[model samples]
Target chain A: MKQRFLNDTNLLLVFSAAILLMPIWLSPLGAAYPDLLQKFAIYGIFAIGFNILFGLTGYLSFGHAAFLGVGSYAAVWSFKLFTMNVVPAVFFGVIFAGLLAFLIGYISLRRSGIYFSILTLAFAQMSYNLAYSVLTPITNGETGLQLTINDPRWIDSMYITVEEGLPSTNLFGLKMSGYPGFYFCAILLIVCFFISLRIFRSPFGLMLRGIKSNQNRMNYTGLNTKPYMLSAFVISGMFAGLAGSLLAVTDPLAGAERMQWTASGEVVLMTILGGVGTLIGPMLGAGLIKYFENIFSSFNKNLLHEVFSFLPDGVEDVVVQVVSLFVGGGWHLTLGLLFMIVVIFLPGGIVEGFQKFGGVFGYGKNKNSDSSPQNQAAE
Target chain B: MDSILIQILNGLDKGAAYALIALGLTLVFGTLGIVNFAHGAIFMLGAFCAVTFRKLLTLSVKVKDESVTMFAAYKDEPYLKIWFGDTGEAIIDYAVPLSILIAIPFMVLVGYAMERGLIRHFYKRAHADQILVTFGLAIVVQELIKASFGANPIPQAAPDIVAGSANVGLWFGLGESLVYPWWRLIYLCFSGVMIFAVFSFLQFTTYGMVVRAGMRDRETVGLLGINIQRRFTIVFAIAAVVAGTAGVMYTPILPPDYHMGMDFLVLSFVVVVVGGMGSLGGAVTAGFLLGIVQSFASMNEVKSIIPGIDQIIIYLVAVVILLTLPRGLMGRAGVMDD
Candidate 1:
C-alpha cells in the first residue's frame, strides 16, 4: 500500500509537471499564435469528457458533437441575452448540454453496441438538419453566428472603461483573448482532468466499469446501472459543453457544422488514437491531431520544395510530392491510414504503446501496479 | 393530381435505390455480423466505374492541323482511335448497361479482398474498432477516388432507349402530364427483378440454406463440417454486388461524385437500423417507408410548416421508432442489449 501510494504520487507529480511545462515550452516557440493553444486545450477537455462515458461504460456515442454544438449555440445565445460575461455563457452552455444529454441518453442508452452508435448518429444528424433549418435563428444556419462589434456588454458598465462601445469583457479586466484565453482553457482542462481522475477512482466509476464488462452481472447484483450510465452521459455532455463554450469565447462563433456527424466521429478518433480508457491519452491524442491539423496543413508545396532543396532534383520533387500527400489535401487519407494501423496493431492506443516502451526500459512495472486495478476491474 | 403522380413515381425510383443499398447492408450485417460502414463507399466506387467506362470509350488522340500553324505545316500527324466498327461503338455507347457487367465482377473482387484482407480480422474485435477501421477505410477510398476523379460530379447519361421521359399515363388512364423518366422506370423494374432473384436464390438454393444456417449459428454449422466463413465471404460479395448495382442504376438520377458515399452512408445506416439489425424484409419495408415519408415531407405543404422536414424526417422516424420500440420495427427481442 505504501509503495502503491508513492507510485500514485509520482504519477500525479509527473502529470502536473508536464501540464505546467507544456505552455512554457510552447510559448518560447511562438507566444502569440492566435488561439492555437486555446483550441488544443478546449478540444482536450471535450475528449476527456467523452472518455468518461465511452472509456468507462463502453458506450460508443457517434453524436457527442450534438452536445458540443448545443453548448456553443447556448453560449452564443447567453451572450445575446444576459451579459457578455464568460461565466454566464459557459454556465448556460453546460446546463443546456446536460439537459439535452439527459433526454438523449435516456433513450439511446437503452441499446448497446452498433445500435447505440446508429441511434446517436441519427439523433446528431437530426440536430444538424434542425440547426440548418428550423433552428436557424439560434444556430444562424449555414452562414454561422458571428460576434459583431455592436453586441451589448452589461458587465462592461460595471467596470471602468473609457471606450464607448462594449469593452471586451474580461476576467478582472484581463482580456479574454489570445494568451489569456489559452490560460483560461488550460486551467479549465486541468480542473476537468482532476475531476475525471476522481471519477475514475470513485465507486461509481467502478460500477461503470462493471456495467461495461458485465451489465448482466451488475443487474443480478441488484444495482440499477441505467442511472449511472445516464449520469456519466450527462457529465460528459456538460464537459463537451464546456469545451464548446470555450470555443465560442476564443472565436465567438458557432456553426451548424460543429454538430455534424463527422465532428462526432472526430472525437471518437481522438479518443481511440490517444487511448480510450486512459485519462491523459485523450489529451495527447487531441494535442497530436490538432497540431497536425493546424500545423501540417499549413505546409505548402513551396515550403516542401525549400525543405528538400538538399536532395537531388528528381528525388527532391518526388519526396516533396509524396510528403505533401500526407500533409495537405491528403490529410484525411493519412488519418485513415493511421486509424487503420492503430486499430490493427495498437488496440490500446498510444498510451499502451508508451506503457510497453516503459516496460521494455523497466520503468513500467511500478506504473502497471496502480493501473492494473482499473484494467482488471474493467475486464 | 398529375404532379402528385409524378412525385410518387419519383419517390418510387428513389425508394428503389434506398431499398437496394439497405438490402445489401442488411445481408452483410445479418449473415456476417459486420456493420460494413464502407458499403456506401463501395456504392460510390460503382458509379465511378461507370464513369471510367464512359471515359474509356470516348478516349481519342488529338492531332494538330498542319494548315493552321507554321510549326505544323510540314507534317500531318496520324491520330489513333480505338473504334471497333459500328456494333462495337454501339456497345460502347451503351456504357450504363455495360457497367452492370463490369461492376459485378470488379465489386465482387473488391468485396472478397476486403473481407479476406481487413474485415475478417475485425470479427472478434470490438464493434467500435470495426466501425472506426471501416469508417477510416471509407474516407481513404473516398479520398483516393477524389484524387483520381477530381471533385466535380460526373454525369453518366443513360442509353438512347432510356434517355428521356416516357408517358406511361396513357396506359393507366391518367393525363399525359403524368410522365416518368424512362431510365428511372427501367431502374425500378431492374431493382425489383434483382430483389426477386435474390429472394428466389435464398429460398431455393442449398447454398442459401447453408448461409442461413451459418447465420443462425456458425459454431453449430462448423460442427456439422460446413465452412461457414466461405459462405459468409460469398454473402459479402453478394452484398457488394447489390450495392454496386444500385449505384450503377442510380447514376442516371444523380451525377456520381466522390462525396456521394458519405452522403448516403448515414441515411443507409439509418435505414439498416430502422429496419432492424439482421432482418432483410425489415430493410426493404423500412427503406420504402422512409423514402416515401421523406418524399412527402419535402412537398410544399410539409415544407410550409417545417422548412427542412424532409432532411430530418427519416432521422425523426428513426429516433421515435427506436425509443418506442427499441428492437426496431422487426428486430428480435433482447438482440439490442443496453
Candidate 2:
C-alpha cells in the first residue's frame, strides 16, 4: 500500500479524487454549490490552458479571453442550429477557438515581447467592439444570446419530438446542469490535466521550454521555433474553447463581457497567482480565486459580526469594521494586492511557497523551478 | 466643407488628451526603461485633484430654517459662499484651474515615492514582471480613488468665461452652425503650448541632454557621475504632472471616474504602440492621428459606407499599421521590436 501510494501515478489519482470529492471537502469552505463548483472546474481548464502558452513559451498574450469568448459563441451557435447534445458544441467550440487562435497567433507571433502583447490586445479589442455593435446578429448584442421555446433545433428534433420548453444541453440524455453538470466538467478537467501532463513531459514541451529560455540559441541550432510556438498557441486556445463550451453547456448564454480585456487579465492573474508552469497550480489558483470571489464578495458587516462574536463587544465591532474593507465590494483590492505580492516576492507563486515550507524540514527535489525570465542587464 | 472643419475641431481636443497621456507614457518608457501602467491612474488622480478642489470649495454648513416648522428644516450653504461672499463664489467658479496648483506638487511627490520606493527595485527585472507590478499598482491606485470618490462620475464645469461655444464658422465666413466650445479650443491651444514647451525643454536644456543620453545608453551616463537616478525620478514626476494636467483640464469634457484612467490607459498604450514605442514624437503624432481617424470614422458619411466603423477603427488601424510597418509610425529599430 505504501509503495503504491508513493508511486508517480499516485499524484494523478490523488488529484482526481480531490476534484471528484469537492462536494465533501469544499463544503467546509462554503463553496460546494453547483454554480460555483462549475465555475471552479471551468476556470481551472481556462487557466491551465493559458499556462501552457504563457508558462512554456514566455509569450504573454494579453488577449486570450477573445478565444474563450469565441469558443462560447461557437458552442452556443452549434446548439442553436444543430442539437442540444454537448458533443457537437464542445467540438465546434474547440475547433473555432483553435482557428481564431491560429489567425491571431500568425500575426501576433510576428512580434515578440511587449509588441506582441499589444498586437494581441489590439486584435481582441477589435473582436470585442465588433461583437458589441456590428456583429449583433450573431452575438445578440449586449442582451446576449438566449434560447426561445419555439426555436428549431435541427438535429435534436429529427431524433425526438418537440418538447414544451426550451431544451437544456445533454450528453446522451444526461442533463448538463446542477451536480451532474459539475461532474461532466470535472471529468473533462481530469482529462485536460492528463493531456497537459503528457505535453509537459513531451519533447515538444522541452523545445518550448528551450524557446522560452533562449530562442536565439534554439534558432542558431537550425531549428524552426515559429511552428512549435504556433502549435502551443493553438492547443492552449482549444483548451480555452473547451472551458468556454462548458460555461455555455451549464448555462446557455454568451456575452461580449466574456471577451473583455479585464477578463483576459483575470486568467493571467489566475495562472500567475497559482504557480506558472506547475500543472496543478493554475487549477488551484482558479479555484482559490473563484472561491474568494463568491465567498468574500458575499461577506458584509453582519456576517463579520457573527464570525467575530467570540470577541468582546468593543473588539468585535473594531474587527468587523476593519475586516469588512477587505471583503465584499472591496475584494478586488485584496486580489490586486495579492497579485502584486505574488509577482514581487513569491514569483513561483503558491506552489513555490509550499515547496519552501516543505524544504524547511528537508523535502525532496523542487521540481517547479523558477520559470520567470531572469533580469540579465545590470545598471 | 464646414462639417469637415467641425470634425477636425472635435478631434483636436480628444487628440490633445491622448497626446498628453501618450507623451508621458513614452517618456517614462524611454527614460526609465519601465512600462508604467500606473501612468493612467496618475491621470485619473489629476482629474480627482480638480474634483477634490471642487469638493473642498463646496464644503457646506447646515443652517436651520426657523420659518419652516413642520419638522426641522435646514438649508445647506457652502462654507466658501458664507466665508467670503462674492470673492469666494468667484474662487469656487475657478476651482478647476486652481487645482493645477495642488496637482503639480502632489503628483511630483507621488511619482517620486513610486519610483524610489517600488519601481527602482524592478528595474533589473524582466519586462513582463515590470508590466505585472505596474499593473497591480494601477489597480490598487484605482481602487483607492474609487473608495474615496464613491465610484461615481463627478462632473466639473469649466470656468464661466470659457464654458460657452464660439462661432468658428463666422470666423471663416462659413455658417453659424459651425460653433465650437471655448474650453475645447483652449484645450487645443493649451496642449499645443504644452507640447511645444516639452519639446523645446528637451531640445535646449543640459539636463534634457543627459536624460536623452541616458535613454540611449544608461551605463555610460552613470559612469559620468551625473546622479542619473535623481533626474529619472524628476522625469517620472514630469510624466505624472503631464498626465495630471491633461486629466484636470479634461474633466469638463468627460466626467471624471475611477475607471476612466483604465479606459484611457489601454488606448494610450495603443497610441504609444501605434506611434512607435519609446518614441515621443511618434507617440504625439500617433495620438492625434488616431484621434482624428477615430473622429472621421464616426462621421455619418463614413458610417454609411462601413457600418460601425467608429467603434473598431482604432484597432483596425493598429492592425494594419503593425502588419505593414512592423516598427510602428516612428519606431527606431531594436526598441522592444523582438
Candidate 3:
C-alpha cells in the first residue's frame, strides 16, 4: 500500500513537473517552435495509441494512418459545417476514426501475421487511392484541404471580432494559432497518456495480454475475446483520431499523404525504436525522430563549413564532405543505420535499455522479480 | 479497339514485372517462411546493374584526324588508340548484354551473403521481427543505392540492333498497326524462358523435389539428414537472380531510379498476398491478372467512370480476394486461417 502511494505521488510529481517545464522550455524557442512541437506531440500520441494495438495485441497494422487521415478529414468537415470550436471537431474526428477502425479491424483481425499486415496495407492503399481520386472533393485530392479566408467562423466571429477576410480558428475565444495550440495539444497528450496508463493497468489490459500470449487458451477458457480485441482496436483508433484532429487544428489542412502506408510504417518504427509496450518510449521515439527530421534536415554545407572552419583547408573540405553525407540530404541513411543497430542489438528498444540501466542502479531488480510472477500469470 | 490493344499490351508488360517480382517473393516465402520486404530493393539493384553496365560500355578512346589533304581528310579512318586500351574499349560496347550475365552471379552472391549474414539470424524470431529487420535492411539498401546513383531516374538504352519497334502488323496484313518494341519483346520472351526454366528445375529435378519436401516440412527434411537451411539459402539466391533478371530487363521500360523499388514494393507484396502465401503458380497468375486489370482500369474510358481505378485496382482485388478466399487463391489449406 505504501509502495502504491509512493508510485502515485511520484507519478503526480512527474506530471506537474512536465507541465511546468513545457512552457519554460518552449518559451525560449518562441511561438513558431511550438507548432512543430505540437506536431511532434500529436504524432507521439498517435504512435503511443498504435503501440497499444500493435505492441500488446501483436497485430502489426499497416493501415493505422487510414484512421488518422479519416479523422483529419472529419475534423476539417466539422470545422466547415459546425462552429470553429475545436472540441466538437476533435470529438467527431475520434468517432469517425473509431467507426472506420471498427469496420476495417473486424475484417482484418480475422487473418493474422503477414496476411493481416497485407490486408491492412491493402485497405490503406485503397483508402489512399480513393481519397486521391474518388473522394477528391472530400480529401481535396493531391492539393490537399486548406482553410480559406472565406471559411465561416461561426463561433469565433460571435465570441470575438477579428478583421474581415482573415483566416483563423478559435477555441472558446482562445486562439489556436500559436502557443495556445501547443498547450492545447500538450494537454490532450497528457490526458491521452493518463488514459493509456489507466488502460494499461486495468484488468482489461491483463486480459488483452492473455489474448496476445495464447489466444487459444483464452478461447478454451470460454472467454469471448473478439469484443475485447475490438474494444482495444476502437480505443486505439480513437487515440489516433485525437492526434489527427490535433494536427488539423494546428495546421487546418488535411492531405491523403497522411494515409500512406509509409506514414503508418513510421509510427511502427517509432513504437519499436522507443520500446514497444513502454508508455514513455513511443513519445520519446516520436520526439527524437521528428527533432532529427526538423533540425537535422535544416543544416547545410555552409553551416558545416562554419563548424569545421578551424580545420586545415584540405582536412576541412574532407570533413565537410563526409559530414554532409551523414547529415544533409542523407538523413534517411542515418535513420536507417540507427534502425538497423537498434533492432539487431536492442530488439526490446529504448525501454529495455532504460530498464537495464535501472537494474544496474539497483532500482528495478527487486521490482522485476516481484512483477515477473504477475506478468507470467497474466500472460 | 486500338486503344484496347494498347492497354492490353501495356498491362501485359507491367504484369510481366509484377509476375517476376511476386514469383521471387513467393519462392522465398514458400521455401523459407520469410516475408522479404527487401525483394523490391533487389529488383532496384538489378536495374542499377544495367545502368552501371551502360556506363561502363560507353567508355571510348577518341582520336583526332590529322590528314590535311581534301580526299585524305575526307577519307580519314579513325584507328583505335591503344595504350592497352583496345582490349578494355572492345569490352565496353557489349556491357549492357554482358551486365545481364554478370548481374546474375553478382545478385546470387548478394542473396547468399544477405541470407547468411542477417536473415539467417532471424529464422527463429517472430514474423514481426523478421519483417522489421528486413524492412530496415531494405531502407538501408535503397538509401545506399540513392547515395551512389543519385535520386533521378537514369535511362538505360538497349543495343542499337533491338532499339526500335517491330511491325508485327505487316505479317498480319494490318497496315503496320501492331508495332511492338523489339527490346520489350525480347524481355517478354526472356522472362518466359526464365520462368519456364525455374518451373522445370523445380518440377523435374530431384533437388527440386527436396526443396518441395523442405517447403512442406523443414524439420522432417532436416530429420532425413538433408541440410534444409543451405537449400533455403540457395532458394533465396535463385529468387534474387530472378528479381535481378527482371530488373535488368525492365530498365529500358521504366528507367532505373533509387525509389523505384519502394514504388513497386507495396504492389508486389499485394500480388504475393493475393497469389496465396506459399503458392508459386498463384503468384504468377495473380501477377498477370492484376497487371491486366490495372492496365484496363487506367484507360481513359474507365477513368471516366472510376477515377484512379488503376491505382487502387490491385489493392481492391487483393482485399476482395482476401475476404472471399482467406487462404488466397491457391494457399495451402489451414495455413493462413490462424
Candidate 4:
C-alpha cells in the first residue's frame, strides 16, 4: 500500500512540476502569457473531468458545455449577489452546475448510446437558445452575463467597501489575474489531477471501466450500473463546473456561446487528441489545442511570406497561399484536417504515436502495441 | 381558428425539410449502420452545389464602357445571356430550380467518393470512432465551403413567379391574411415526391430488397453470395443525393450558410432518434410530428402560456418520447434498443 501510494505521489509530483514550470517551458513557444496560461489550466480541468465519464464509461456526451455555461452563470451571479471573493462564487458555481448535471444525467442516462447523446444535445441546445433569446433577463442575451456597478454585493458591503473602479475577482487581497491567476488555476488543476488519479485507481473507476467494456456482462454478474454511471456523469459535470467557474474567476464574463455544441465538441477533440482515458493526456491535449489555436490564428500573410522568403518569389507566393489556408480564418480547416488524420492514423492519439515512435527506436517496450487501437484508446 | 390553420401550414413546410433530411439519415443508419456526423455536411455540400451552379450560370464578362468616364469603365453581363440570349436569362432566373439537374449527379459522386475513400474503412470501427471521424470530416467540409465562399448567409431567390405568398387559407375558408409562401408549397411537394420515390425504391425493387436483407443481417446477406457492400454504398450515395436535393430546394426558404448544415444536423439527428435508429417510416412520421409540435409551441398563445417552449419543445418532445416509448414511434424491435 505504501509503495502504491508512493507511485501516485511520484506521478503527481512530476505533473505538478511540469505545470509549475509551464511559464518557463512555454516561453520559447510564446504561449507563456498569463491569460493564455490560465486558459490552458482551465480547459485542462474541463477535459480531465470530461474524461472521467467519456474515457472510463464509454458514454459519449454531447452537452457537457451546458454544465460549463451553467457554472459560469452561477459564478457570475455569485459575484452580483455576494462579493468579488472567488471562494463563494466558485462554490455556487459548482453547486448549480452539479445540480443541473444531476437532473440532466438522471434523465439522459435512462437511454444509452446515440440516443443518450442526442438527448443531452437537445437539452444543451434548449439551454443555449433560451440564454440567447427568452432568458435574456437572467443571462443578458448575446451581450453575455457581466457584472455592473449597481450590483448589490452584500458581502462587500459588510466587509471592505470598494470606492474605486470595478472590483476584480480575488482571494482576499491577491488578485485573480496575471501570474497569480495562472498559479491559482495551476494549483487547482494539480488537485483535480490528483483526484482523477485516485479515481482511476479506485474500485468505482474499475466498475465504470467494466461497464464500458461490457454492460450486459456486468449486469449478468449482478452489478447495477446505473448509479455508477450516473455518479461518473455528475462527478465529471462538477469538474466541468469547476473549470467554468475558474474561467469566471480569471476573466469574469460568461457568454451563451460557452454552452454551444461546438464548445462541447472542442473538449472531446482535446481529450481524443491528447489521449482519452490517460491520466496526463487530457491536460496535454488541452494545452496543445489551446497552443495551436493561439499560434495558428495569429499567423498572417506577412508572417507566411516572411517564413517562405528564402524560396524564389513565385514559389514563395504559392507556398504562402497554400499555407495561409491552414492558418488565420482557415485555422478550423487545419483543426479539422488534424482531427481526421489523428482519428485515422493515431487512434490512441499523441500518446500512442509517441509510444510507437519510442518502440521504433528500441527505447521502450510498447506493451499497448499488442492491443488493437480502439481498446488502446484512453487506456 | 385561422391562426391554428396557419401554424399547421407552417408546420408542414418545416416538416418537409426535416423529413427529407431525416429520411437520408435513416437510409445511412439502416444500410451502413454508421452514425454519420458528416451527413449534415453532405446536405450542406448539396446546397453549395446549387450555389456553385448558380455562380457558374451567372459567370460574367467585362466590357469596357467609354461613355461613363475618360477612364475605362467596365459593364458586366452574364455570359449565359450572351450565349443563349433570353433562354439563358430564364435559366439564370430559375437557377435554384435548374440546379437540381446538375446537383443530383454531382452529389452522388461526392457521396460515393466520401464512402469509398474515408467511410469504408470505418465500417467495423466503434461508433465513437465513426462519430469522431465523420464530425472531423464535417468541420473540414464546412471550413472548405467557408474558404471558397465567405461565412455570410448567401440568399438565393426562387423564380419571380413563385416568390410571393399564395392565399393558402382561402381553400380552408379562413381569412386571406393566413397566406403561405409558394416556394414552400413547392418544397413540400418536392419532399413528398422524394420520400415516395425512396420508399418505393426500397419497397418494390430487387436491388433494394437485397439491400434491406443486408441491413437486417450483413453476414447472412453476404452468405447468400450478394455483393451487399456495393449495394450499401449505392444506398449511401442515394441518401446523399436525397439530402442534397432537399438542401437545393431549401436554399430559397433559408439562405445557404456554412453553419446551416450543422444546425439542421443536430435537429435532424433528434428527428432520426425520435423516429428510431433504423426505422425509415419512424423517421418520416417523427419528423412531421415534432415539426408540428415545434410550430405549435411557437404560436403566441402557446408561448404566452409556457414561455420559451418554442425554443425547446422539439427537444422536450424528444426526451419525453425517448423516456416513454424508448423505441420511438415506429421503431423496429431490437434496433439500437440497448
By DockQ, the candidates rank as 4, 2, 1, 3
Q: Which candidate ranks first by lDDT, i.e. highest? A: 4
Lowest summed lDDT across 10 adjacent residues in model 2 chain A is found at A370-379
| Candidate 1 vs 4: which has more TM-score | 4
RMSD of 1: 3.4
For model 3, the superposed segments whose C-alpha errors exceed 4 Å read A1-9, A12-16, A23-32, A153-162, A308-316, A366-379, B1-5, B60-95, B168-176, B334-337
Writing each residue's lDDT as its tens digit, candidate 4 over A1-379 gives: 2344336788899899999999999899899999899999999999999989888888889999999999999999999889999999889888998999999999999888877888889888888989998999989999999988888899897888677778899988899999999999999999999999988889999998888777889989998989998999999999999999999999899999999999999999998898877777789889989988998999999999989999999999999998988999899999999999998998887877887887888864553332235642221
Q: Model 1: per-residue lDDT, tens digit, B1-338?
A: 87667667777777777888888888888787787889999999889889987776766556556567776544422221334656666776688888888899999999999999999998876667777889989988988898789889998889887788898898798868778889989998998888887777777999988898887778999999988999999899998988888888789789999989888878888887888878888888788788788888888987998788888889889988877876677875544444
Question: Which pairs clash inside model 3?
Answer: none
Error of 2 at B303 (Å): 1.3
Q: iRMSD (Å) of candidate 2? A: 3.2
What interface RMSD does each of the candidate structures achieve? 4.1, 3.2, 4.9, 2.9
lDDT on C-alpha atoms for all candidate structures:
0.81, 0.88, 0.80, 0.89
Span of 10 residues, lowest total lDDT, candidate 3 chain B: B75-84
Off by over 4 Å in 4: A1-6, A363-379, B64-74, B172-175
Candidate 4, residue B270: how far the Cα is off, in Å: 0.5
Indicate the residue-level lDDT of A300 in model 3: 92
Q: What lDDT score is found at residue B51 in candidate 1?
A: 91
